[model samples]
Target chain A: MSSPATQPDFGSARPGGRTARTRAAVRDATLAELAAHGYRGLTVDGVAERSGVHRTTVYRRWGGVDGLVVDALDLAGEDGWQPPDTGGFAGDCRALAAEVHRSFADPAQGAASAAVVAASFQSPRAAEALRGFYADRNARSEVIVSRAVDRGELPAGTDAAAVVRAVVAPLFHRLFITREPLDAGVAEQAAEAAVAAALAGVFQLPSGA
Target chain B: MSSPATQPDFGSARPGGRTARTRAAVRDATLAELAAHGYRGLTVDGVAERSGVHRTTVYRRWGGVDGLVVDALDLAGEDGWQPPDTGGFAGDCRALAAEVHRSFADPAQGAASAAVVAASFQSPRAAEALRGFYADRNARSEVIVSRAVDRGELPAGTDAAAVVRAVVAPLFHRLFITREPLDAGVAEQAAEAAVAAALAGVFQLPSGA
Candidate 1:
């Protein structure tokens, strides 16, 4: 049961002089519905019913399911836990891996994610949103890897993008395909393997190895 | 519409003493339907309709959609363009990449593959079938990498499993997530990068790097 009035307008300024309380209510309610029903099961009517908001108000505010989903995903992506900056590549990787494990380990988050991925396959808008989510994460990972390169912990010419892809590929493979729990030890091993391989020259040095 | 009599039993062998031509026709029809309708849209009824096979026959043979899909995938996988036996690591990689491109470039094969992947997310049978497919391909790729190690083309102790994973990772990413055409050039570049990096000592090196 979500209270739609509690949901927040992510990064967007409140329109029509809507109060902060109403927006927060709406956003919070939406999150609850998403967690409970998943993307496919969520509907605007549910949001309106749970939030005690008028259906017209919900429609006027969000447009449709896609808009609501986008807003909800934005909120989730932003409010979701962030990895600690551990000051070095290895530590940063461990922190990042732990955050991923935590996020996917939650039943609600994991189901919501799978639902979104499924919906994305059928909807171009949702696909774009999914891409944006990955792009942001990839950018953060690149920063960490670059720091490693700068420290000479990895070769100068390493393909940072590929390395970043490698770091999370196994985690995602296990999560989405195998539906397996991502143990912390598995995360550590993957991170260690990726780092070791990258340093040894897996992605190719900038010039030639 | 499918012919009812043409369905081949996947479990039982030639119960009606049907000729090989009948089984081939049914399998080909199944693949065509898979490409046309995707996994979700495809149904046993539809396959029966398309192949002129009886629904009971299909069920008796393959069990359900998952079983039918497994048969279709097996059929598709058998239509080979395997890697040539290149003398060295670089040559072997090029051959492997070429094979990847050939497989993905085929419209029929690519669509069927995407359908299979999407289905795997929801069905355990599909997941098992997909895993078997990957494992077989992995085994084949290992032999090529092993040859490289023997020839001193790659460092000893190089992780053949990891290298194979890396080589195909981008192609799958592009094929599944990005929904991009996996062109031959992209495959070639990926293969070259993987071999060069692995040979340069990215993973564990042999006694003499």
Candidate 2:
């Protein structure tokens, strides 16, 4: 599952040194470029110039714009992000869904996130990175579902990953697929619907994998 | 809200004549090209050569690749499609969700539909066309929800469009956003989840718009 772009070899560079600094600079530049001009305007040269890295170094490291986009998204996983931890399952779901809205509503994160999503449609590397990113997130989110079952908020054996996906899928569908407008109301409804479905055992896993 | 690409002026050409034949040829050629190479490989010259239409005619009428993609999708609306008519609300929702999976599973339809969705990311005109297409579809699908209300399957004043979006959004999120696998089971689950939410009164709109 590993690609050359996403799993780059930082030869001869130690941690917190040249390799780390260069990665940060390029990552920031890619986000800025995506916010400014989107995926269509992102270029290897543009990133090199913006990040103050040599053009040759950028090309040798990233290969092309697709590489840059993929790596930038891969960088998102470095922060060890976690899902919300509200006391109740319903509140946790709402908070989780609200986070989806807040990301898109914020200009900086919205542009970069949206561009990464758009780029994934074109680049298999980017798509792979996206899948990995979400897969990690889904795994982490399973904790909430488990907690819900323990607290008797949901039935035992509810599919945790499926419940997490159901909680946020409508928001993404509006944001990226349908290009529809979103507000707090939309986020709340997505959460509420998911909670209701979970309560109804809509997320129970089948007999076996 | 109108764009030249989506709202093309089919000037002075009667139906089933030279203009109609040319449009059909170009549309078919576009779909074939997308199936083979995706949105990144699509080009006006390639389409023109494949369609056997004059290069100048293709350029003058379609403007460019984006125009061709938008128009190809716009043609989909001409079919006067309708939602499934399964008497039970749960059955109707399941059929509706099944349609989403079937579109992406069919060989010819899958490639073309995915390509058009990819193209929409780069072109506002294509995005506009997509929104219009789905808006029409969402409007049409509202009938099932209303029928459910009439049949006492769901509570009255349930937001029909919201329920329709909920029914299909999970499948789309899996197919497009997460790049995850989908199956017949996934489709039925999405339908069941939406019905559970709708029956629980999660989709009731606020007092005012």
Candidate 3:
């Protein structure tokens, strides 16, 4: 639930003041390095050199390059985008879908996500972080669906988790495999389609229950 | 459509009769090396030494390690363990879902797929090969869903592509992210859920239309 913008600023001077400035500089350098060399090629030493921070300070704050990458992803504000809380399930899904499309379409986000996904394949810590990121999105969508269920718009015992997966799987597929530019309109259509399916009992209660 | 058992033996010698035995040995060596060293560490000379094939012959057949890896994957076969054809939509889904579960649960397949996915990140040809593999699976599912649509078991304009994705997405998520085993029962439930939702008009037609 921490917004990416408010994550510990790696470049800002810490409470010791000087440390804060160094942290901010280190974070900025990390962003630049990630954009240029990708996650596989990034190193803590490179970030320290680029930011004029001590290697010890960089390590002390972030643990290592993987931690540094996680913080950088956080600092880069990749988690700030959220779907509008539209009243209806369809509207909420559309909003969520559109937001996903816009985020994946953005060059910065797409590159960062790709880097995270690639890194996750090799690193347990990175994999956990990436999973946490997606789980958060899934949780958000679940709330909306639950609300619809409460209002009796959806049948009881609907699998909210499955519904969330249904909504975003296409967007993720496009981002990871196809590398296609996901647009708002496409997201809207996908969202509408998903919601329509869910409402119709495609991902609903089991039989004879 | 090829069964894993019937694919051309990459291990067999080439058309020159005597050369065919040498080629099979070389290809088998390559697979062993890949399983041990992965894509980054595999080398052509090592394969030649292991298989006792001449280095020139290895080069002539595969061009290099990348080509060899591609062929290894191809020779591994394209059969995704399709579900049996059941007349009902739910039955068809259950069959495919079980197949996915079986494939991913197989240790050999799971590891091989992970390696291929990682290698695809670095090799464009590998990426294309991986895409071709999945595209074939998706196309097969699409045909099943299309038949259901024809029987009016699903919406007239059901998004077969989306349905196919929904069917397989959970299994992939479990395999890659959750590291969970996809059991037959889970696959059957997932299929039934998706099919039921689709029948209820979740994915097709406009929202509230």
Candidate 4:
């Protein structure tokens, strides 16, 4: 598959051997379908046609639309993504929050991201795949908190994942839940709130609990 | 018309005359359809049958499934919903967060609420209804911050709606975006984090900005 590489921030499956290329091709088609027509419009034949793979091969490999979405999510999780490293915890939080805004609110990428979220609501396997994908991301983001602890910037026991969640939650809430408008201050304010909470040790777990 | 009143925690339509009764029945049926089968399964005929209203009347009034959802959401906004008032700002934050957990995580109401959110993603009118609903809710919740300012518990310049957003954003993130598991600590810790941030004046907007 050609590495199309449309967007630079969000991960894309790397080009490799024939099998890997096929997988990447199928995943790319799946995401494009989702972005353009949403989950309800995805079909096995559609993906096969879009990917230029044989219909029988596509059906046998993916089983169905749910399978396609699940596999695409799994592939996405393995793409070696990392959080920003800004040296300072507050700065890192701001960078991470802004990144989320760009990834999920930007016109180029937000539609596909939103469609996947909507697909999860429609399919149990898609929801599970989404859960696993985010779990991997949360684990990867913990390095930001660990570095802060090492530099004496935050409490030793601060919950790294919780801090990450705080930094991005308001943006997600506005984008998905409340359907509110977002501006430049939305990301900055959310990051600042997370920084303040982390400084107060609000995320620190009780010892041995 | 009977004021079935299945759940008490989330608001129910208030007692009223015949017009209100018809509206309540249709709203209840619309919510039931959304809860049971989600937005995809809701239909004008289904709502009409479930509501015991004529199909002609349902079509004439609601137009279609999206219209049914929009009307239900509008009616829900009209219900007298208020945030918790537990005296202390911290206590109120805890209560408000817990209220969100109960309303959105409880199996009885969560499905319907989730369906509405999912519907907004699929329909422009539904999105508008969801926006209006949350805007009303956010405005109502501002009292929590205003009271805190009045009692000198938080800075006078604090953004009331911003504080409310902080209190519930994390819970919505976990429940919807990441599909993460929620426990008792989820709501309490979220409230604590928001309280810490608010106390630090992180939510205070610049003067005249």
List DockQ for all candidates: 0.18, 0.78, 0.32, 0.78
What's the distance in Å from true for residue A44, model 1? 3.5
Model 3 alpha-carbon drift over 4 Å, by segment: A1-28, A73-83, A178-186, A200-209, B1-36, B45-55, B76-83, B155-159, B177-181, B200-209
Tell me each candidate's TM-score: 0.72, 0.89, 0.78, 0.93
Q: Which candidate's DockQ is highest?
A: 4
TM-score of decoy 2? 0.89
Residues A1-209, candidate 4, lDDT per residue (tens digit)? 11111112224656699998899889888888888888999998889999998989988998989999998888877665678888899988988877777676567467777788888888899888888877777778889999999999997988888998888889888988887877768989999999999899889977812
List the pairs of residues colliding in candidate 4. Answer: none
What is the full ranking by lDDT, best candidate first? Answer: 4, 2, 3, 1
> Which tens-of-lDDT digit does each residue in A127-166 have in candidate 1?
7776666655565557777788788777777777666655
Docking class of 3: acceptable
Q: What is the lDDT of residue A85 in candidate 3?
A: 69
Candidate 1 chain A weakest ten by summed lDDT: A1-10
Question: How many clashing pairs does model 3 include?
Answer: 26
**lDDT at B108, model 3:** 57
| Candidate 2 docking quality: incorrect, acceptable, medium or high | medium
* Residues A1-209 of candidate 2: C-alpha lDDT, one tens digit per residue: 11111111112122388788899789888878876887778888889999999989999999888888777766766654567778899998988887778767767667777877887887788889888877877787788899998998888889999999998899989987788999989989999999999999888877622
Residue-level lDDT of model 3, residues B90-194, one tens digit each, is 777777777667655556554555666666666678777666666655665677777888787876777776577666655665555434456876676667656
lDDT of 4 at A161: 86
**Model 3 lDDT tens row, A1-209:** 22221112123222347665565577677766766776667898999899988899888999988887676545443434444567888887776666666554556655555666666665677666666666665665587678888888888788787677656665665555533446765566557656766776766657612
- lDDT score, candidate 3, position B101: 71
Tens digits of lDDT, candidate 4, B147-209: 999999998889989998898888888888888877668889989989999999898888923
Best by TM-score: 4
